[model samples]
Every structure is written in C-alpha cells, then in structure tokens.
Target: MEVHAHTHTPRKKWTHYFWEFLMLFLAVFCGFLAEYQLEHKIEKDKEKQYIHGLLEDLHEDTGTLSETINEFDGHLKRNDTLIKLLTSDAIKEHGSDLYYLGRRASRSVRLALHDFTIQQMKSSGGFRLIRNQKVSKAIIEYYNRTVFIDYLNGIESNESDEYRKMAIDIFHPVTFNGIVNPDNTIARPENNPPLLTYDSKTLLRLAGMVSYIRNTKQGLMKAEIEMKMAAIELIQLIKAEYHLN
Candidate 1:
C-alpha cells in the first residue's frame, strides 16, 4: 500500500465565524421582534374586545336604570296619594282607592345591573389587560356602587313585603279580586272591599305602611339618582378612553 500525503482543510477565520454568528443573531432577533409585535397586537385586540363588551353592559344598565327610575317615580306618586288619602276622612268612604294605591306601592322594581362583561373580567382576571388605569378604576367603582344599590334594594324589598302584609290584613282577598275582572280589565264590583272603614288597629297598620312607603321611596329615589350619575360617568369615561362617540 502506498502512503498518500493528506492535505487538511484550513480552519475558518475568526472573522468568518463572527459574521456567521452575527447573521444568526440578526435572524433570531428579527423573529423575536415579529413574535413580540404579534403578541402585542393580540393583547391590544383583546383589550378592545373587553372594552366593547363593557360598553354594551353599561349602556344596557343605563337604559334599564332609566326605566326603573320612571317606574319608581310613579310608585312614589302613588304612595304619596295613598298617604294623603289615609289621613283624610274620605278614606273611610273610598277604601277601594287604597287597594289601588297599596297595590302600586307594594310592587318592588328590582334593578338588574348588566354585569356579564364585568363578571367575566373579574372571574378570568382579564382586567389586567386594560391599559387605561382610569377605565379600570371606574369599572371597579361602578360595581362597588352596584353592591350598595343591591343592599338598598333588599331593604326596599323588605318594606314592600311589609306593605303587602299590611294589604293582606286590611283588604279582603275576595274584594281585591273584585277590582279585576277575569278579562284583566279594571272593574268595580258591588261587593268590592266589603269594608269601607278601618278600626283602630287597622288604622295603625295603615299608618305603618304609609311610613314604610315614604322611607322606601326616599331611599330608592336617592339610590336611583346616584346610580344614574355613576352610570353616566362610567359611560363618559369609556367613551373617552376607547375613542368612541
């Protein structure tokens, strides 16, 4: 066997190695930047989606609150009328009118807050995605107020319950039935409200009912006003933060 001389290839220069390293580093850096941009875009989109959902919820809440406010205003007026009638001698002759007034006052208008979006944010810990600190704070404050409103609503419901109990004690069930026909129309039967006047005990019950209605009405009115103001403020904040009209 003949021995051949082996020629070894030259090692790469350091500059060559450095250029290769630089190229690899540049490529990786570009890819990382692209990925970061994509992630940022996704986060921004998610934030906007949350904001839009919150806007819808706030709008719904405001609308419902307006309707509820109007309904409670009517309730307040009816209760006021009942209070006046109860204090007058005419109530002895027209006890049927008290039935109408009591029926209105006894109704509880539950204000349902639109909290689907907020609840989701809270449960999922998505509130961190909101970049605007003001928006986050406003949302928190609004929900907090809602909690108070709910407590007030509970008190109002209790008052309404008491009023209903008073109604059961003072008015005959059969007589109340006489006020509404089977067709659901307003009607006054001859035997409606079998009694026209209340004794001392019943009058005392009426007085208590009137006092409760007044207190409930006042508390509800204040709560409604505050709720409306909060809603309006939140709406404005959302609009400003989201650049919405």
Candidate 2:
C-alpha cells in the first residue's frame, strides 16, 4: 500500500480561533456603540431646537400681553381725565359738549376693557383658570349692566336728575356700612337704604356694575402677573431641560 501523505495545513489552534472570534465581536459592538451615540446626539439636537422655538413663542406672547396692559392703562388714564372733566363746573354748565365727552370716555373705557378681556382669554384660555367662576360671572354681569347704561344714555336727556344720579351710580356703586367681622355677612349698597329713590332701581344696578368692575380689576391684575411669571418659569425649564441655554 502506498503511503498517503495528508499534507493539509494544520488547523488553527483553538486559542487562536477564540481570539479571532472575540476580535470580530468587539468590532461589531464598537460599531453598534458608535451608531447609538450618533442617534442620541441627533435626538438631543432636535429636542434642543424644539425648546428654543417654544421659548421664542412664549417671549412673543409676553410682549403682546405687555402691550395690551399698556394700552389698557392709557385708556384708564384718559377715563380718569374724562371723569374729572365731567365733575367740573365749566363742563357741567356748558352741558352738551361735556356730556358727549363723558359719554364717549365711558364708552371708550368699556370698549378698551372688552378688548383686554378678549386678549386675556386668548392668553390664558379664559378667566376660569386664574379666577373663580363667581368672580368671572360677576365681571360679565357688570359688563352687561354697563352696556345697559350705555343704551339708556343714548335715549335719555343729560339735564335730568335721573341722569345725574345714574352717572354718580356709575362712579360710586359701593358703600361701606359698619365694618363687620370676617364671619359676618357683608353689607352691600343694594341691601342698605337707597340714597336716591327716584331712580333707585336704575342707580342700584349701575352701582353694582361699577363695583364689580373695580373688584375684578384687582383680581385680574394679580392673575395676569401670575400668568406671566408662570410663562417665564416654563420657558426657563424648557431651556434647562433641553440644554438650549
């Protein structure tokens, strides 16, 4: 029998094969780690952009709010001037011009307030979030009452005492009776004796409207400032969370 020489190359050692397998595994793992890091960076960048955009939107909204407040303040100042003019002897004696001016000022104030209310609604999704329903309802009722006065003013003559009382009612709707304990029920003008009975019903209604406006203004201002602060805080949180700086 011829001696058959098996001249196959010696198989690699088990140790060498083990090392080669480990090297291949490590390479794949390294590639996977690099891909994961790249994807993570991309995601983070997208989030950063989103936060920056939101911050910009908040800033714009804040600006709009500030502008609205400024306009409202101006309207209030003008209304104050008109009130002074209405009370003056010269305007009262002269009659028609001052009466018209006063009426116009009152109308202007109400219109400005309406615009402000609309803006507030847009900014905060209505007063319900910042103020209680009772307060909001009071405000709406006051506005309706004022609108009624406006309607009456259009037809009624200014020289009548009824009109003068109505104007006073528009200005001073609330009166303080004896101060009471917190537990006691508050006394309002309607419950108290009427100072002017000729048009007491009309005057009382107008007084209530004015009182409602005054009370709601303070609450609205506080609520507005709080809303601004909340918006600013949210913006800061977004900046920090997304590393938007």
Candidate 3:
C-alpha cells in the first residue's frame, strides 16, 4: 500500500487583496460621481422652468396693474364729482345726475393679481430654486404686499355696502335702473321717467355718505398706488435678472 502526501494550495499575497479592494472602491466612487452629476443637472433644469413661469406671471401682473390704475383713476374722478354734488344744494335740483353717478361712485376696482407661479413656489417649497437672492426677496415682498392690498380692497367692499344702503334711501331703484343700459352705459329710460325727488332727510343721509366716501377714497388711492408701484418694480427686476425681453 503506497501513501501519497497531500499538497496544500499556496495562499494569495497581500498585494492581490489590495488590488481587489482598490478596484471595488474606484468603481463605487465613479458611480457616485455619475449620480451626483445627474441630480445636479435635474435641479438646474427645474430652476429654469420655475424662473420662466415666474416671468410670465410677472408680465401678466404688470399689465393688469396698469389697467387697474386707469380704472381706479376713473373711479376716483367719479367719486369726486359725486362728493361735490351730494354735499351741495345743487343735488336737490339736479338729482338726475346723482342717479347716474351713484353706482359709479361705489364701484370698487378689483386687482387681478397673477399669483399662480408664486403659489406653486410656496406650496412646493421651490423658492430655493431661485438662486438670485434679490429675485427671491422681491418675489416674497410682492406677494406680501398683495395681502395688505387685498385687505384694503375688503374695506372698499364694506364701504360699497354702506353706499348701496344710503342709495336705497336717496334714489328710486326703478328710476336708477332705467337710466343705466343693459351694457352698463347710460341711456334714457324707456318711459322718459321724471328725475328722482328726495326730501331734506334723504339729503342729510346722502351728505353723511359723501363724507364717508371722501375719507375712504384716500385709503383706496394709497393702497392701489402702492400696489401698482410694487408690481412695476418686481416686473422690472424679474425681466433684468432673467434677461427676458
């Protein structure tokens, strides 16, 4: 019987293990770098999209603000005319003019704020996407001012309610409606109705309403003017920053 000695395989050298570890580390590091680059690109694209949308909103707000300013200016003039007529004795003789002016005097100018992009930024926590600090701050301030302006507008609405109540006492509703056309233009009533007749008591009430309106008009003017200025400033800033035409 012959016994053969078992030969054991040689162990791997330390250099071999080291090379294996180095290859694994390099592969993992390269994969991490690739993933980081991809995420960075995606974030950049998202930021541009947000900026473009914000620009559109700003443009719309600017245009609307211009129109609002014109509308409010017209209302202001009407308010002034109504105040003068209601405070003086002339309103008693020319009461027909009051019928035409009452509705215009109480008309509130509503602001059309284009806030869709800003709302999205707030809800999505995407404000950080705007890398420009000035742009971000301007955007925040513009929206914040809108809240105050809206509060002022609510005051105008309350004043309008009061004006309407006073009008009910001073003007005949059927006669007033007759003067206003369906398209909101002034037209003589179909029946060629007589002018509205009011007593001293109604005149006193109308005089008080005129005083309230005179005081309220100043506040409305202040708020509307400030909002318009703010919108213009923000529009300019956004256009400059984004290089928009």
Candidate 4:
C-alpha cells in the first residue's frame, strides 16, 4: 500500500519552454546588431585616413609652386636693375660689354617667365577642386597667345635695337592725317620707335598674372586642407559617439 502511493512530479509547461527560446533568440540578435555597428565604424575610419593623405600631397605641390614663383620674381627684379644700368649714359660709353650683359639678362628673364607660366598651368590641374583639364588648357592657350604677341613685337630680347622699335609701334600707334596709324605701313622692323625696345612692361604684366595664378593655387590648396580637416573631425565625432577611439 505505501509503494502504490508514490507522488508524480508536475511536468514543465510548453508555454514556459517557448518563452525561454524567445529570450535566447533576442540575445543573439542584439549581439549581431552590435557587431554590425562596430564594423561600419571601422570602415569609415579607414576611408578618412585615405583622404587625409591625398590632402597632404596637394599641400606639398603647392609649396613647391610658391618657391618657384618667388625665385622667378627675384630674377625679374635683378634683370630690371641690369636694364637700368645698361640704359645709363656712363655704361653706354664704357663699352659693348654692359650692353651684352643687359641683353643676356633680358633673355634669361623671358625664358624664366615662360617656364613659370607653363609650370603653373600644369600644376593647376593637379589640385582636387581645380583639376579641370579643359579649363587648364584654355588658360594655357590664352597665355600662349599673349606671349606670342609679345615675342613678335620684339619684347622677347633686348639684343636688337631695330626690333625694339617695331614692338613699340605695335603697342602705340601714331596719328596720320586725323587717323591713328601704326608706325610702319607694313608693320616691318625698319620703321618703329626706340622706347619699345625693352621688355619691362611685358615682364610687369606677366608678373601680375603670375601673382593671380599663385593666389588661385593657394586657395585650392586651402580648400583641400579644410576638407581633410572636416573629415578628420567627423571621424573623431563618430568615435566619441560610439566610444571606439
């Protein structure tokens, strides 16, 4: 009679088992969400580093351009002084050596200016924001046209007195019979003025243009730098937000 009175334990409810399964599923989903967020943040940080490196390269190129322009400007000023010396009556009476030196100086200045113009045009396309090939080509063409006119008008060299007069006539026309006429009927080298023999004015104009180009280059460099800084700041903000520095 005592053996037949064994008690039966209560079986676990199916509803309780279902609840435990749901809790385990929720825990796994939460872990997956956290992992996805961590991976996304890591990818963003890597991209920011890549952009910062590009900006550094642009800064270096801009610095090189600035140095080249400065050196060229110094050369131009020195040439100007040599020109003044050559034009002096004392130097003229001394010998042809001073005149030859003046001619060499003028030639050097012209070549240096041309090189600077070409280099600037090329460098303009290297920037991130200003790297438009079409625009750069247009600018180069315009400069080349102006330089051609300058050279044809005898502005390239101070070697020939005859050529200098021709350049002056092209710049300033004379009046004849109430009409403004070029000094030479055929625009030949034989008929021209003496004042047009030096390249001081053309050099001055080129120098001004160079300054403008330099400013534009600097602006582009600054913009690129700012862009990189902003990206870095955003990365720091995200790291702070997620506490993943």
Top candidate, metric lDDT: 1
List residue ranges in candidate 3 displaced over 4 A. Answer: 1-7, 184-197, 214-217, 239-245
Work out the TM-score per prediction: 0.85, 0.43, 0.84, 0.29
Off by over 4 Å in 1: 178-192
- How do these models rank on lDDT, best leading? 1, 3, 2, 4
Candidate 4 accuracy as lDDT: 0.41
Worst 10 residues of 4 by lDDT: 184-193
Per-model lDDT: 0.78, 0.45, 0.74, 0.41
lDDT of 1 at 34: 100
Put down candidate 2 lDDT per residue, 30-142, tens digits, no spaces: 99999999987766565444334445656765665466556446545544554454444454243333333333333221212223433444475543332234433533443
The weakest ten consecutive residues by lDDT in model 3 span 188-197
Using TM-score as the yardstick, the better of models 1 and 3 is 1
Each candidate's number of clashing pairs is 0, 0, 0, 0
lDDT of 3 by residue, 51-90 (tens): 8887788778778877877776776676677777766765
lDDT by residue (tens digit), candidate 1, 1-245: 99999999999999999999999999999999999999999989989899999989888988988988887787777777777766666666666677766555666777888899888988988899999999889888888876767787788778777777767767778777667767754454443354544665676677677778677767877787788888889989989878999
Can you tell me which runs of candidate 2 are displaced by over 4 Å? 1-9, 71-198, 229-245
lDDT of 3 at 153: 77
